[model samples]
Target: MAQRLQSISAVTVSGALVIVLLLTLTFGTLGAVAFRADSLSGLSTRDWAAVRFTVVQAFLSALLSVILAIPVARALARRQFWGRSVLVTLLGAPFILPVIVAVLGLLSVFGRNGLLSQALGFAGLEPVSIYGAHGVVLAHVFFNLPLATRLILQGWLAIPAERFRLAASLGFGARDILRHLEWPMLLAVVPGAFMVIFLICTTSFAVALALGGGPKATTIELAIYQAFRFDFNLSKAALLALAQFGLCAIAAVISLWVSIPAGQGAGLDRVVARRDGSRILDFTVLLLVTLFLITPLGVIAVKGLGSVLSLPASTYGAAGRSVCVALASALLTIALTLPLALLAQRVSKLIEGVGYLSIAASPLVIGTGLFILVYRWADPVVLALPITILVNAAMSLPFALRAIAPALAEVERDYGRLSDSLGLTGMARMRLVILPRLRRPLGFGAGLAAALSMGDLGVIALFADPDSATLPLAMYRLMTAYRMDDAHGAALLLLSLSLLLFWVFDRGGRVNADI
Candidate 1:
């Protein structure tokens, strides 16, 4: 019965995606027509500025985030200190924190009247503007640093202790030990993390738009948004979207082409010296990085306190809609992803690679494709919230796989032999066994989908109307109008929603023994 339900759910989900793809293709064509020939023409000086600014900002953001993460990650990996788990989990908060929320916090602390400004009050010294190119870089770093730290920490943990032990036994110093084992781990993880951060920065819309302060610092995503929203230049937006897609495609190709060592087959049980010569350095770096990463949230909390009650009823309405949409999307995402995951597991190892491909494709690109499809059928794609849910689910599939694949592997390893011995195969075995065993992964994936959908500004940014806005869209709207207080309030709400959903789903996964 469970297997039958799984099969049915999978079919339904695939069918929904097909419809979504068809709708998006239509929207893309219409957008193309709306943009016209001139929109697709060669770059203007403004375009050149945007292109240059985007590349530099993204490259720097990726580089800085990864570089700053190494020490923090090393500390987390090496020390079994108090509050380690809390710190590790806190790193994940920024992942779900709304861009507007982080921006607001950054502005409150780093802006002219910000806390730091008051601290460094000097005659003839002006306040630092958390706006323009600097602001964009700051926001990107804020968002990506924790993520990079976590990724690199995992890499650091993957190194066998035996390698470190061997080094210690050979009288190798800390520097020598790092050169041999740690450097290899860094080489393997840094590029991949950089690629992830770069891809995120490439499609950055809210951060650029809110912090950009003008035309000078616009990213391609911002340019596209401006063309569509401000100028009503659909052709321009369409052309820019095409360009953005091309660039992302090239980046994705390059990332895959670069050969990096995988984490697999690493020694797991090499005992290394816990006390190292670099302890002081590692502690200081960890302290600094943690403070930097957490400061934005702290500022938000301080600044946002007064504005919570000032939020209008509309904000609450939008929040409700966002919750509903996220919940629906989570369920639908799990429904669709489970079948695909199972199919991949059953067919070939290569099928598993699809998960990573989905990860590399920014949410905005997928949203664009679906938006293009939506326009073919009608005027307001925003009215079709059901379709939005499906798209959100598909978008979350890559992360879902990351969360579930390991558990799925373990389940297969433990149960495969038993199922075969019992003469159980195909639908019967899957229904009676596999689906039940997969409950934990399903819950984890569902929660992740819900949490991600809760905070998404991409698809809704393209399709949202006055009446159709979700929480993130509402928050962006507030920011665009320079309603910092309202935006801050909304950001807090969104952040809470994301974290709560994530916690709920994660707990479900844990109870079910998925991870």
Candidate 2:
């Protein structure tokens, strides 16, 4: 009994540590940045403009992403043609894809000299420019559309076959089906999906940096970066960071109230046999979505092959560093997530909310805070990689927790008494009972964290000196230098590494996850 009590205490303490770490890294950094803000000047016109642009873009991005995703997700759920599984799997790529790489891909598709422009030029039309607020919204849609599709698709798949059958037998038309079956699922899932994507777009830094920076285009996070990096105006940066935090906090609060719906009333594990939609429409929706998402990737692969053989050693070194950081971040995420997951509900709800705040918090804001906190005692450059790892892990915490926490809870609920009666506690219980059951989510969450960290360009860009640059940062520098060939090659490499890291961990988890 004493040993079991000690084990439980240790788990509780570790969970508390995870909460403390999240608080210190998130709000603690925000607080440090706050102290440096110039209260007298407040936000300039440019600052307020950035703030408005940020909110508008995020709202538009989320709205459009969810709206477009409905048809695509419905098409996917209804159709099971060849390569369907592959198509579904690929939908997840944009989530882990490097932001710099994604920007490059977007440029290749929609830039003034890109395919769209070329087609227009062939028709003797003017070239369309992708360099402002519209471009930012477009890029965000590219990233979030797939996410929205997957979420809504999951909802569609959860609709029991009986529901569709019953509707069909009752002579339900498309309108009738939408009213009875689809509307409920969309109502339950779409709000959560929109809020999640909204929060994501609100904290965007790299997308705005690459495609939007004019008076009407700059986001709050981008403004913070400009103040810190170009102007060397720490006060302005701090103030902008505070604004960004307020925006995210508001969005997070809204998201909290908008809970992602749980699985609807379960059916006898059956595939939904959807029949209301037209085959032509379904096929067209699938094809358009595939082309939109895949063309950029195809361009990357083709363009990258020509220059990958000649990439500079510096790029390789940066890649190596990114890999190291990714691995470290993955391990740290797993460690922190496990304890936090194990101790869920036993810990304070406020602490859990703090852990999730990382989702809404800007990585740039966190990095800036860290620089401020560390500058008083240590070299920020020297701590760049470490801070990147810590921040990346924190940035990934909400997703990991969402994935792993429920699974851990389910395992503990099912086996708690069994383990206790068998005298299995501490390492023995974790290893023999909890872990085997948790392999799927653990591996998946770890993979997600690793891939995200590998492709992370946010915090590293803030703190990295030349020597400490990650591949995404180095790739961005190359792009800025007009080294298109090298940038494309580096992007391909980063994409491959991100995908591979995710695959390895995800596959490892599923290999024997039938427990």
Candidate 3:
């Protein structure tokens, strides 16, 4: 019975994988159909400019983020001080943070009437503008720096304690440590990190639209938005979507190729206790990096406190809609991800790769393709909320898989044979053994999915009508309309909800949980 059940499970999972593949292929087909004879000929001087600007800014953003993360990661790795754990937790906040909220926070610190401009004026220096390419890069760096630091810090933690002890005994100095211990890890980690950030920035829309200043800083994503939303040119949008798809696919392939395993192991609790790094240098790096990261969030909190209550009834309506979408997306993401992750334990690499297809495919491309595909058969605007939910869920699947796959594998490995011997098969085994054992990862994955869905602005921007605007879109409208007070209040509310959702689910998973 157990053998039969296992066979049935495998077959079911494989069929699910095929459905996912077919769904992805449909995007390509629809995109191809949407392309017109003059789609390529439709490319204007401004379109080419957008293409150039997109690649340039993404490369610069990735480069600066990785280069600066090294010292910060090293500093955190070597130093054990008060609030280190809190700081490490804070490092993860930016990854799941709402892009629009982060933009507002950044504007509070770097905008024309911001603190930095005022300080520069007082010091008799020219007040700088946070617009154009520089502003886009700054925002990208703010979002990605913490991600890079966490990745590299994991690399540092993965280094064996024995190696550090031996180096210390051999009288290895900081330079020696750098040459032997740190450099190799950076070589392994930096490329992957750079490629990931580059891919992320390539598809950025809100940051570019808000801070790109004008067409001078427009990215391919912004171009796609313009073609679809402003010009209502489906063929041109399809062509631009194809271009963005190619860019992301190439970056994703390179990222996967150069990616190190992030050194996941059991010895992280055993600290290396390095004797090489300079105390003064580590302190300075830690201080500056912390301030750079925390200041924007602080600005949001301070600015939003007074304005929160003054937000309009429409803002609350948008918030309610956003929460519903987030909840539905989170549930759907886990439903799709869990089965695939379970199958991944025994499936081929190709099957696993299919699960990650959404990562390499631009959200705008997916939205555009789906819009074209659905428009032929139904009213696209009426289905806008549902489509947004589906796209957000798909976008969050990769993260959900990352969170749950390992735990699923471990559970099956540790208990599979035991369950079989005990005549535990199918649902009985899952309820009594699997669910209990997998709660932490399941909770964490669900939390990440929920938070991510709540903050997403990409796909919905393409599909949503004015009446269906999610909170992020609504907040964006407020900003564009120059309602700074309402925008800041909405930003605060969104920020709080995202963090709260993450905390609730993540903490729920850890509570009374068996390691």
Candidate 4:
């Protein structure tokens, strides 16, 4: 009876936290709406244009990312070589890589003075510019392609070796193998990957701000930033935020509907000898994909080596602020995620839908709303850092839940009854039976939250006073000032800090951890 009461208490606490998050979002959005009730007149022509451009770019980015990922994922799945595991791990890098860093790296490879343009100029050919709509698409593809590839690769890996063996026993050639086995898997996986990437691209702020050369290429997110930061038009910002919220929510709903879990069940590690895919073709694909992903990162490292130590003192100050925010966010996220995950083991469907609300939310909307709420009571700038930390933690909850929930459920499934029978309730049970087994996922989730928070530039950009800029925002300011070298240095610092935080947390979790 005591153990049951403890379980109920856990569930109740988790449910209350979820309710608080939902209420915060709901009331904040509604409050912004009320504040702008008169200004909620129809969207201007420019607003419509922003909406149109946003959807089109997200669609194009998602389509191109998934289509390109297919070949790369297939090649990786079939080819066995030295450093395969390393390559797979490298794919996760883009997830935590700061957007500004990626944009700079990409510019080094595709900008007017870049290698491609220089080679073309040497050959008496016209230099190509990487700006406008195509530039935005290129950046999105760079970031999302690896994500799509990993998702598709997970699908491929999930296919049982026994199935492959059966197909081979029937003398299935390359064409037959693709037609019979691979096509079906793609059918199940691609749409979900496309939708997920599309939703992500919809909320893109940093990439669009940098690569989108002008109004012609501007995304809705950039428009929101302009409304809030440059124009100081809270009404217009709120309106745009609502529009963005609607767009992402619709996409999120569709994604939830069409999404088949890609990497769910385990597969045998045995390699199935397959009579498919040309060795030459696989090698070419692998080489191009590797170059595409690796060159920009290499440029960042090489270019920053000369100037990384010469960054302005303000850069280090911003880095310190960012570290504090990231650490706080990570700790908060883990605290929120643990109970939510534990509760999710009992009410998965409901908890999952609620968790996705964060993804559908616009950071600008939340910031605008909070600014309205707190400005009435106190100066918004005073609460800026705390609000940023809370918002970052909220933004990270879904991912943290994804990392931790499954492990919690698995533990409960495997060991719940044993603990209950032993009368192990409350803190003792958690420390003795639950936490020791949860180290790996907890560590990974915390690391991910920290890295993401460290690099995030959304809410903070709206709230930060001059003295309160975070690292990413500091880098943006340097770029805007045309201090390219300083910007590179800041990027290097931000990148190193983000990766180091992730490595330390992840390694900590894995030490003496059970698989």
Highest TM-score scorer:
2
- What shift in Å separates residue 493 of candidate 2 from its native position after superposition? 0.7
Q: Kindly report which residue stretches of model 4 are placed more than 4 angstroms away from their true locations once superposed.
A: 2-7, 34-41, 260-269, 346-349
Kindly list the per-residue Cα lDDT of model 1 for residues 1-515, writing each as its tens digit.
Answer: 55545655664566456434433433444344344525445456676577678878999999999998888888888777778789898898787676767777788789877777777776556667788898899999999999999989888877777766767789887788688778877888888888878877887777887788466788887777777667766556666666676667677776666537755466777545476667778778878877887887776766667887789889989999999999998887766566556655655656556545544444555555455555668674545466567667767777787766676677778887887677666577767777777777777788778887888777677677778788888887887788888877787778778889888986876684532
* Comparison by TM-score, 2 against 4, better one: 2
Instruction: List the global CA lDDT of all models.
Output: 0.73, 0.89, 0.84, 0.84
Best-to-worst ranking by TM-score: 2, 4, 3, 1
Q: Per-residue lDDT for 263 in model 2?
A: 52
Question: Best by lDDT, which number?
Answer: 2
397-493 per-residue lDDT for model 3 (tens digits): 8888887878888888898889878887656776788778878987888899889889888888988888888999999999999898888899999
Q: Could you give candidate 2's per-residue lDDT for residues 243-316 as a string of tens digits?
A: 88888988888876886574557678776566787999999999999999999989999999999879999999
| Total backbone collisions, model 1 | 13
TM-score, candidate number 3:
0.94
Tell me how candidate 1 scores on lDDT. 0.73
- Report the lDDT of model 1 for residue 280: 78
Q: List candidate 1 segments past 4 Å from native.
A: 1-42, 122-124, 262-271, 354-357, 381-384, 420-431, 512-515
Query: How do the predictions measure up, each by TM-score?
Result: 0.88, 0.95, 0.94, 0.95
